[model samples]
Target: MDIVLQQMHYCLTDDASNWLVIAISALLVVLWYERKRIKEAIKQDKTH
Candidate 1:
């Protein structure tokens, strides 16, 4: 019983870490896309 509980705890920790990594990656993607859009807008403004 103790070993099973330990295993479960380990699995939970691993899943939590994986979720954290995924969230960070998604945030970075959004930031990168926003930055690109801002840059384009600036370029357009300069042209006008």
Candidate 2:
């Protein structure tokens, strides 16, 4: 498992690392938006 992790670490060059960070940030943003939207929907449903 350690060897696999080391190989993956070496495979990501500088550009790949930047893209990975961007992709993770975008994913987190989308998840946050979805969670907020769902909470609002549930609140509205409870009111109705």
Candidate 3:
């Protein structure tokens, strides 16, 4: 019983870490896209 509980705890921790990594990756992608868009807008403003 103790071994089973330990295994379950390990699995939960692993899953949580995987989810955290995915969430951070998604956030970085969004930030990168937004930065690109802002730069384009600034370029257009300067042209006009």
Candidate 4:
């Protein structure tokens, strides 16, 4: 029973880490997209 509890704890922790990584990755992607858009707007302003 003790071993089973330990195994369950480990599994839950692993899943939590996976979710955290995915959330961070999604945030990074959004930041990158926004950065690119801002750069393009700056370039357009410079042209005018």
The window of 10 residues in a row where model 1 has the poorest summed lDDT is 1-10
Q: Write the per-residue lDDT of candidate 3 for residues 1-48, one digit (tens) a residue.
A: 999999999999999999999999999999999999999999999999
Question: Could you tell which candidate, 2 or 4, scores higher by lDDT?
Answer: 4
Per model, state how many residue pairs clash.
0, 0, 0, 0
lDDT for model 3, please.
Answer: 1.00
In candidate 4, residue 6 scores what lDDT?
Answer: 100
Model 1 clash tally? 0
What TM-score does candidate 4 get on C-alpha atoms? 0.87
- Runs in model 3 deviating more than 4 A are none
Give the root-mean-square deviation of each candidate in angstroms: 0.5, 7.3, 0.6, 0.9
User: Highest TM-score, which number?
Assistant: 1
Q: What are the lDDT scores of the predictions, listed in order? A: 1.00, 0.93, 1.00, 1.00
TM-score-best of 2 and 4: 4
Clashing pairs in 2: none
Q: Is candidate 1 or candidate 2 better by lDDT?
A: 1
The parts of candidate 1 lying over 4 Å away from their true place are none
Model 3 — which ten-residue stretch has the worst lDDT?
1-10
lDDT of 3 at 19: 100
Count residue pairs with overlapping backbones in model 4. 0
Q: Write the number of the candidate with greater TM-score, choosing between 1 and 2.
A: 1
